[model samples]
Target chain A: MKTPLIDNLQYANFSPAIFEQMRAGGVDAVHVTIAYHETFREMVLNLERWNRWFEDHPDLIFKGTTAADVSLAQKTGRTAIFFGFQNPSPIEDDIGLVEICHQLGIRFMQLTYNNQSLLATGCYEDDDTGLTRMGRAVVTEMNRVGMVIDMSHSGERSTLEAIDHSTRPIAITHANPHWWHVALRNKSDAVLKALSGAGGMLGFSVYPHHLAGGSDCTLDSFCAMIAEAAARYGAEHLGIGTDLCQDQPDSIVEWMRVGRWTKGIDYGEGSASNAGFPPMPSWFNDNRDFGNIRTGLLNAGLEIAQVDGIMGGNWHRFYQQGFGPA
Target chain B: MKTPLIDNLQYANFSPAIFEQMRAGGVDAVHVTIAYHETFREMVLNLERWNRWFEDHPDLIFKGTTAADVSLAQKTGRTAIFFGFQNPSPIEDDIGLVEICHQLGIRFMQLTYNNQSLLATGCYEDDDTGLTRMGRAVVTEMNRVGMVIDMSHSGERSTLEAIDHSTRPIAITHANPHWWHVALRNKSDAVLKALSGAGGMLGFSVYPHHLAGGSDCTLDSFCAMIAEAAARYGAEHLGIGTDLCQDQPDSIVEWMRVGRWTKGIDYGEGSASNAGFPPMPSWFNDNRDFGNIRTGLLNAGLEIAQVDGIMGGNWHRFYQQGFGPA
Candidate 1:
């Protein structure tokens, strides 16, 4: 059997072209962020959009809810689109919605999105309160319902507390290590050590802000960072989560960062001068260019198995262990 | 390998007890009616309930959308609970919601219940107008989206029109032959002939009033009716639907019969004196009694292959053919 290739995080405005590119890239599964800061009903509308895509492109993709779906996608030569939330806004204040969202085929939900949510503190918040009371209950509920507690945009204390409180191994679905790139969204060394030590996963982000050299970051630098992280964290929990905002209008970035939370603009990673998505590194432009990363990882002194795991195999294993009731 | 066992239709107040009985009966899959006269939002609440059941009892049941789920259910020793709608109220007046409902895993949608709808004339209507403009559009849309057009409670002209209008073979998901038992819900010879001739399916209903002798109907008589149906309509198009309203209270029956359409009770299949769910025949008490029908079919001089098909294999083949983009 071919090793599965998965992109564990993306927020692309998906189309048939992207799905075709996924097939060309031999990507078995992709955990697509269906909700960033949308309300419960709004998240359902997003699901409706995806449902239309699934109907329109059955030959290229289908909804993926389990690890076995990766194998199914590989066998069928299609991409399995798994749903995730970049924020816990979809659940609102209801703990019951954790299981409800899981039933809707959502497998991952970030506790915060660069601000204080009902559950936890975001990375951008001044004061880092750990897991709130609701957060602890939601963590337990998420564990019970097989929905992974994602902490990609959450504060360090909150992320650490999530890793501590969750009976199931949580995930930083997309973000880099702070030691590699000092972006607010990136994880610190302590957080990385704690995450991996607790059998949690850290999916490397290719979003420009999370990169050391921003848009000008080379494939070699990216691969070297992967190699370094693998060396430090032991490669088992490493995988790619290319937060690729492909084909989306700059307006979507505003929605992602701002999303009815504020009247005026809050330029998340970008300044007023550059308040939009940045250019991708040329070598890793899109899914079809995943070959470049694999080649780069191999050239960066990583073994074939390590490269394979980083590409998708690790996420596959993580999905197997993580997306089921504890 | 054991032959798959499927019940093509039911509307039980499903619980762990019902799911366990389904396992005890060795049923692989069941097509459950999730909507009777519920509006779109109300139906979502019902889906939430089923989702809870699935989460709570993963060992016993899981949602089934495709035909492959049957084999998967049998292999995993669980029942695949497939979804359907006995009425098109959930879709409201929007043709787009057809595909949306299909995306939400609704496999079957009847054009009407017991009154004239936006789509077609119900069986109890004064005049039988065929497929409406919306009905034809919905039929084509349903075919394209792979949701079955169930004509169980539709008027004769409408049912025939649907059988002809549908690019894909429509289904009388839970109804009996009118020749065997004269009832408003039972289909006529012409309808069944057109259904089978066009590669459609007839899921025999044991819904008390549809049976010749009501609740006291014998196993021999029921299986003999199956034998007669196989003789007339061909065994390939026949399977069990049961219409098993198991564990539902009289109030639920009231809802099924007189949703929000009328202020007064309609008593769909029963009179004012008998306006509640009737007791099931002694031979077919619940899902656990499926074995009795299998034996009854064999005793009624059907070959083992024929028995197997009626039991579930035929419905499995129908499901495979029916549930996909056409």
Candidate 2:
């Protein structure tokens, strides 16, 4: 069978139309962000929405809890949607919520978004304190329960600390290399090296702000960057996350940035001149364009086997290896 | 392989001591009430406490999610603690919370708890309007999701409505027959008949207020009453719930009856002369005394199989048949 197509991260304004696009693209699995800056109760409300969607369109998509669910969806000709969080707000101050979120099928959780969380410092913070007292407890609990610690939006120190502290392999689920892109959201070489060296993964992002040329970055440029990342950090640990925020309202990005943390707007990743979600590169706008990425990776002097693994095989193995009890 | 000792209802001030008592009593499983008047968030806090207990005492007790857990608990020499709610307050006004609560291992939820909740009228309400619109929706959702719809403290009309409304067999997890007990918490004859006719269970409660003569009632009286209930509703429809609120302070009863609803004390099920929890029956005070009831049932002239069913076999069958997706 063709390699199962998986997007390690997405935060779409989900609907049946998008689900249909997933099937049309042969996408077996997509880790969808159910909470950005939501509290535990608010995160439950988001899950309720997904539950409704799953009930309404059982033939289109289903909630995926294990790596085997990808194969199940593939055999059934449907897409499996896994749940995740973009920030630690969903867990709030409670370390118990780490297991609770895992029980609810939250496979990935970023410790920080763009500011200091109760657990760790975000990339936007001036001082880079690694992990708080609660952060260490939460990391051990998350490791015990099989929830991946994603540090895509976390500070450099916090990311490195989490990699060393976690007993299980972690992931920077949707970040490019800082050397490839001069963006605060991208990962530094040290973070990437520590992550990959520890059997972790680095999913290359297609989100404009994390790309070299923003929305104008070409398919060749993106894939060649992935080829370079594979060379630096072994092809087995490289995959695609895309950081796709498909069809979401611009106001959502504001919530992702400013959720109850401040009384004023922060305008994350954008300024007054461009204060909204940037357009996607022409070659990759939706799920249907995963083929462009696969073709581009092949043209970037990567072997067919490497391209297949980068597309989704690597992530499928990661899901199998780490998304369960330690 | 003796019949599993399962208490279908409890709200004890749980600890290692109580769990030790459960082991001494040879209890295999318990349906523990995790909420009374708690909101969804507050109920979660209660679950977090239980999570801590389960973590700390895995050898003595563990969280039970399925009927098979009873057998597992028996094999492992531990008590499996199943979760339930005595009121609809945990779900608030959201029907979606039914499925979410079920997913979180909530096996049972009451429609009301001695007041006019958003779902249905409680036994304490003046006018019995039966099931509200939301109550109907919640019952169907609960049925679909394998959560037992419990109406142990509901009004006659509301209980009858629930018995008819739910496709799966509902339960009165902790109440005696009103004809025998003359208490507001007890089920009326019609409610009991309908419940039994629909293959439901009536877990006889030993709470002092629900007894024929309160704390003065004898073990023979309780066992004889169980015999009469078996004559009317068959032995396959009976079990013991006990409602053992062991080691709880009197203040906990106040919270159960008047939680944030009234500014002044309501003195539920008690007179002004005695405004706290009444003494439990002399023959039954804690988990270690279940053996007395088993012996009393046999002396009350029940066959061994009939007595065994009343102990826990009936509820085990009900759990296996009902606690899964319809």
TM-score of chain B of 1: 0.99
10 residues in a row with least lDDT, candidate 2 chain B:
B268-277
Q: Give the alpha carbon lDDT tens digit for every residue of A94-119 in model 1.
A: 77778768867999999999999999
TM-score of chain A of 2: 0.99
Error of 2 at A230 (Å): 1.4
Candidate 1: tens digits of C-alpha lDDT, residues B1-326: 68899999999888899998999999999999999899876787788788878878999999999999999999999999999999999888877678767767899999999789999999999999899999999999999879999999999999999999888888898889898889999999999999999999999999999999998889899888899999998898899898999999999999988898889878888998998888899988788999899999999999998989989998999889888988
lDDT of 2 at A205: 88
TM-scores for the candidates: 0.83, 0.97
Model 2: number of backbone collisions:
0
What is the DockQ for all candidates, taken in turn?
0.20, 0.65
Tell me the tens digit of each residue's lDDT in model 2 across B170-279. Answer: 99999999889898998888888999999999999988999999999999999999999999989999999999998899899999999999999888788789877789
CAPRI-wise, candidate 2 is: medium
For each candidate in turn, the interface RMSD (Å) is 3.2, 0.8
- Residue A119 lDDT, candidate 1, scale 0-100: 97
